[model samples]
Target chain A: MLADIEEFYRLDRLPHIWCPGCGNGIVLACLVKAIKELKYDQDKTVVVSGIGCSSRASAYLDFNTLHTTHGRALAFATGIKLAKPELNIFVITGDGDSSAIGGNHLIHAARRNIDLNVVIFNNNIYGMTGGQYSPLTPKVQKATTAPYGTIERPFDLAKLVEAAGATYVARSTAYHTRLTTELIINGAKNKGFSVTEVISQCPVSYGRRNRFNTPAAMLEWQREMAVPVIKARSMAPEELEGKIITGELYRGHAPEYVSEYTKLTQRLKEEAEGV
Target chain B: MPKDPANIGKPEVAIKDSWCKGCGICVALCPKKVLVMNAQGKAVVACPEKCVGCKMCAEHCPDYAITVEVE
Candidate 1:
């Protein structure tokens, strides 16, 4: 089986460091499947990630992977993309890594509409740093920091990115493996900034505290909570509450950052030559 | 016993216990219910005959613990 998809991963780095029942692997597999289906040039594709369990995926993929500082995967990826516009850049980040520390970068990147595929592994807590509640953690969810249940509302990451001007925005959970892969593939193929928020499971860190003691239970929760975007359209707001809307939520075209920059450079060169 | 042509050289689900964390994603996702967790919690192919080589288990296994191969 490994032989079938050997080119997509660095098998030598197998036995990944993620804890048992962690959904990061499922997201990773989906991403690999999407890349394979798209037939992207392996040599020209770069996987960038920030500090977190999900970020560790950069090391496992056999692409031009970059493990950047905490909350700075997009920042690093921005530079990489500007320098080499031909490369396909995919940024892998976690909830805490992206929504909290890297919140500003995420917004700016989306606003710029850069040609970057961003996948957020939203496990609701900081799994790598000990189950702390993240910006995406639900209002009543228990976390190390929120022992008595969180008081603040969680960030709707897909909506946030869409509002921030991302060309593509979608959401999916680990249980919806096929949907996740399809959304990711579409996100990757989008011309401008694309964000796919994968509501992953942190069984050990998140589940034990939230009564979802096993990966299967957490996934089942995801299955129950996820409603397709089209189906969700017919449901009332009240009925849609607490349910994740999965599928392509939005897709719109805009001038990608790299191409805009190139045009600017050409214009400036023409002006200089005229002078 | 005469073997059906469709059943001849059928694929078998292989379990790599050392890598399997017994998450049961494969068990839940198996369309044919060909797998079940044993006493040790690791997934085992309970009915290989039911396996249609959909490879859903292989594709979704987080641990890369299950693989389907034709003998």
Candidate 2:
């Protein structure tokens, strides 16, 4: 098993930290494969993360990474890209980190249409600080904090990003490893801000409390909820209601953050010269 | 001959002793012989050089204690 892992993974760093059956490790594998396939300059690529189990992604990759403050990976990444526009920036964040405390930053980053790739690991709970309810946790899902079941409705990450003006928005799950990796790789290649919300499983916290007894059972739930975007659109609102739509939801041409900022710099230079 | 000499480096693993309940599952599951129990019986990296970051400890930890941080 380890031999197979070493062939594609960083073998020296064996025995990862993710709990048994946790989906974060799978997501990490997908990300690493995507990076390798793209063959991007490791020196020019930066992986930024906030506090959470998923945030550990920054430390694992052999690239320029920034482990920033909670809910602030986007802010730090924005500054980094604005300072050095040539770098390829990737943000790895968990559901709680991106949508709850960092919700404002997430929407604003998309609205600005920055040239950053964001991978949202939506496990529906706060796995690091104990299993607590997250913004993406479905209504009535039980969490450590919501022992009686969560009453509040959940946030639709893809719709939120699309409405915020993200140039590309897609959804995938750890269950769909190949497709998830493809979405991440394509998101990286997209010029304007691209976001992929990966609805993953947190067996220890999210699953155990929500009545998912085993990892396999939890994965089955994801499979059931996911509906292809094309099929979903053809169905009426009644038919599509309650179904989780997966695939590329929205893609449009938009000016990247760097190009827009470049125009600003050129204008400033011309004004200074005239003065 | 050394197999890709430049590829050799330190082993990596995500250690969260606080999350470890000393269940010893990781010790039993890791095929690389990488994890070991410390004085308190919590899982620790004993032969990390043998580790391949296969994520066995993380995927198996019932407590969500560890997350592999590779470099």
Candidate 3:
């Protein structure tokens, strides 16, 4: 049984849709590793995703999956949670699909502290649809939509989730393979809502438009951007600029939606028995 | 570590010449440096020995002309 899980997660799915050196494959591997480590009831684990290159996850993973409309993954995932609270729901989306079109769903899901694991593949562009600007595309970065440079500020996903009331939040990149896997594993184990933002690379669209011409260069950028959170605390904001921060951004305990509702029902049962 | 280029499987990385569009994205991003743009501006696996099967070319190719298959 364990062997089945291991073999299923192999990188044999080529030719992959992402660029050859793109980090989405690495992030996908880490996610599968986390899922295997948890040994959650595979039948009960549902992978819900929206439209984008990252959203292609549903087609590859061997689990109950729902490939929903663009930026509506969270809405469908919410319905799944409300109907089958016992199941472990995971929402896989891209920076644009989730943060731009699906932003409200993301905030409300976190606000409820729902028992869902959200993995945002932040490649900084709308890759699957075509090279386009996304909400998380860094300021001044070149994209198909932004020929000269992007003017809008990017969203710091980890902080956004924490602010929205997600119980557990972490950040990692495709370059940090082991660390990313660990974060996903921990996020899956958390009882309440968990979010793991995986900063992946879009070598074809994002990299080519920008100065990063090679996959190695893209990988190097991921390495250079990452700043361990413990070290980030003491460093100046200037030091943190152009650097990716990877680690447990925030983790707190909250009454999980399903468990709390179950408790409420149990308490009502006890009161009725006394009557 | 020096990547063993010959150890990369497949006799020779071949791209359907007609399918190629002279997009140098593959030439720029290949970690193995196996591909190069010929005078026709078409991507060719000039140094198949350097390929690592990382799939960067096939992944980056906008036209889906590149294929990395195992022999």
**Per-residue lDDT of A236-273 in model 2, one digit per residue for the tens?**
98887667788888897887878999999999999999
- List, residue by residue over A91-209, the lDDT tens digit for candidate 1: 99999999999999999999999999999999999988888999999989899999999999998888888899899999999888889999999999899999999999999888999
Task: List the lowest-lDDT window of 10 residues for candidate 2 chain B.
Answer: B2-11
- For all predictions, the C-alpha RMSD in Å is 2.4, 7.9, 6.3
Model 3 chain A: worst 10 consecutive residues (lDDT sum): A1-10
Give the lowest summed-lDDT range of ten residues in model 3 chain B: B56-65
Report, to 2 decimal places, the DockQ of model 1.
Answer: 0.52
Two-way lDDT contest, 2 vs 3, winner: 2
DockQ values of all predictions: 0.52, 0.07, 0.08
Q: What TM-scores does chain A show, candidate by candidate in order?
A: 0.98, 0.94, 0.91
Tens digit of per-residue lDDT, candidate 3, span A14-102: 34455555566567767877787788878888999998888987877778989999889988987898789888888899999889999
TM-score of chain B of 3: 0.77
Candidate 1 off by > 4 Å: A1-3, B1-9, B69-71
CAPRI band of model 3?
incorrect
State the iRMSD of every prediction, in order shown.
1.9, 7.9, 9.3
